[model samples]
Target: LCYFQQGSQSHSVKHYWYTSWPDHKTPDSAQPLLQLMLDVEEDRVESPGRGPVIVHCSAGIGRTGCFIATAIGCQQLKEEGVVDALSIVCQLRVDR
Candidate 1:
């Protein structure tokens, strides 16, 4: 966890890691990754005023992009009954 303070206000940031994923390869199972995402989402929901989550891997492209895309897609599916993966990936690429 990281702590930041400004005047009398203080905040902390915690990092979550997924270690089952192999180097330069996809995870053996999506279940663990999905559970991790769900845990992160639960944390976000529990902390109403928390800052946006920051997700990253070594290169901040391949796995990072997939994580973000999946999270967003899940949210979209919950709210809109569909996932626009193409658009999400395109936007993530453009933003990157």
Candidate 2:
């Protein structure tokens, strides 16, 4: 996956950091690398009038699905004071 910092005025990025995913289950196990990725994303978000983050995998399906689910769950949490994403996904699947 690639991490990028985008400028506000243009769609092109100002800076980027790239890394291969490590065989780690937890973010804590990949502290430095994970932090670097987060920092790049944060920088992009902080750019004035920046557009949405464009995260994509080659297939852009599996990871994209998870990210969309996570974002929806996060918004729901803020709105309804829920505490879990897994539970939300489970409930959504069940409700459907």
C-alpha TM-score for every candidate = 0.89, 0.42
Query: Mind giving the per-residue lDDT tens digits that candidate 1 earns over 21-66?
Result: 7659978899988999999999999998898999988888778888
- lDDT of each structure? 0.90, 0.54
Q: Considering every candidate listed, which one attains the maximal lDDT? A: 1
lDDT score of residue 96 within candidate 1 = 89
Model 1 TM-score relative to the real fold: 0.89
Number of backbone-clashing residue pairs for each candidate, in the order shown: 0, 0
Q: What TM-score does candidate 2 reach?
A: 0.42
lDDT of 2 by residue, 12-95 (tens): 555443344322332334455445455655776688676666555446554444444655665676689876777867865674
* Candidate 1: clashing pairs of residues: none
Number of the predicted model whose TM-score against the real structure is largest: 1
Error of 2 at 70 (Å): 0.8
